[model samples]
Structure formats: structure tokens, C-alpha cells
Target: MTVALMWEARAVEGRGEELLAWAKARVLEREPERRETFRAPQDRVLVITWWDAEYDAKLPELPEPGDELVTRTVHRWRFEAA
Candidate 1:
């Protein structure tokens, strides 16, 4: 099975660049099959990692960034390939 994990965060006003840099620098304990990062107009950063594992299997994920870096708590989601 294939599982994809999504991590999204909204940066504090005017801190998008810093937040993007921070997200790009994070390294997972185990490398995923694939990973991608994206940003939006509202200072939102999104990271998606694809893994070769069952939906409920334990896997490495990006940790939350510092509170000062984000406007609110990070958002996460898990999905299985159809």
C-alpha cells in the first residue's frame, strides 16, 4: 500500500520566507518515497510525503515548527492511494 502524509502550516504575517526555509530544512528520520513542498498566497506552506507502508503503519513525519513561526497549530492528514 501507499500512504501519503500532508503537513500544512500558516506562517505569521510577513514571515512566509522564514517559514518556507525552515520547512525545507527539516529532515525526516527515514526518507520517504517522495516528498514535495508548496506555498500559497496566504503564507501557507504545505508538505506532502509519500511512503510505501500501510495506512496505519507507523512512519516518520515532519514535526511542528516553533510556535513563533506559525500563526496557529499545524494541520496534518493521512491518505491511502486508491
Candidate 2:
């Protein structure tokens, strides 16, 4: 099975670039099959990682950034390939 984990966060005002850099620098304990990062107009950053694992299996995920880096809590989701 294949699982995709999505992590999204909104950085503080005018800090989108810094947030994107931070996200890109993060290293998972175990690398995923594939990973990608994206940014939007609202200073939001999105990261998606695809893994070879069962839906309910334990997996490594990006941790929340420091409180000063974001405006609110991060959001995450998981999906299984059809």
C-alpha cells in the first residue's frame, strides 16, 4: 500500500520565504518514497510525502515549527492510494 502525508502551515506575516526554507531543511528520520513542497499567496506552505506503508502503520511526519514561525497550529492529513 501507499500512503501520502500532507502537512500544511501558515507563516507569520511577511515570513513565507523563511517558512518555506525551514520546511525544505527539515529531514525525516527515514526518507519517504517521494516528497514535495509548495507555497501559496497566503503565506501558507504545504508539504506532501509519499510512503510505502499501510494506512494505519506508524510513520514519520514533519514536526510543528517554533511558535514564532507560524500564525496558528499546523494541519496534517493522511491518505491511502486507491
Candidate 3:
């Protein structure tokens, strides 16, 4: 089964594009089965990465974008394919 990792960040004010670009660049280094990025109205960026591995397996994760770039702390969630 594939493991799906969800990463989310809410950029401060007008930094949504910057945050999106950062995520895209980073995720590209570790190619996954599937990856998708989304932006919301309130500068929220969401990235979903799907991998063929266990949830407990060690995997590269999105790092925090720091308080200067984001309004709230980054969020990460892991799930196994149903």
C-alpha cells in the first residue's frame, strides 16, 4: 500500500507564492509516486505526497518555513492507503 503524507503551511500575508515555490523545489529532490500542491484564499498552501512505503518508514519531510514566512506552525499527517 502507498503512504500518503500531507503537509500544510499558512504563509504570512502575501507570502503564499513564495511558500509554494519553496515546497515545490524541495519536494522535487525526493521524487514520489504522486505529488500535488494547492493554495487557498488565506495564503494557505497544502502539499500531498504519495509514496510506496509504510507510514513508520523514514521519509523526507517538509521543513518548517519559519515564523517569518508563515503565520502558524507547519502541519504534517501520514496515512496508509485504504
**Highest TM-score against the true fold, candidate:** 2
Question: Candidate 1: minimum summed lDDT over ten consecutive residues — where?
Answer: 60-69
Task: Write candidate 1's Cα lDDT for 1-82 as tens digits.
Answer: 9999999999999999999999999999999999999999989999999999999999988899999989999999999999
* Pairs with steric clashes in candidate 2: none
lDDT of 2: 0.98
Error of 1 at 29 (Å): 0.2
Each candidate's lDDT (Cα)? 0.95, 0.98, 0.87
lDDT (10s digit) by residue, model 3, range 1-82: 7999899999989998998888777844567898898988998999999999877988778889878889988999999988
Instruction: Give the TM-score ranking, best first.
Output: 2, 1, 3
Report the lDDT of model 3 for residue 64: 90
Off by over 4 Å in 2: none
**Top model number, lDDT:** 2
Which is superior by TM-score, 1 or 2?
2
lDDT of 2 by residue, 16-75 (tens): 999999999999999999999999998999999999999999999999999999999999
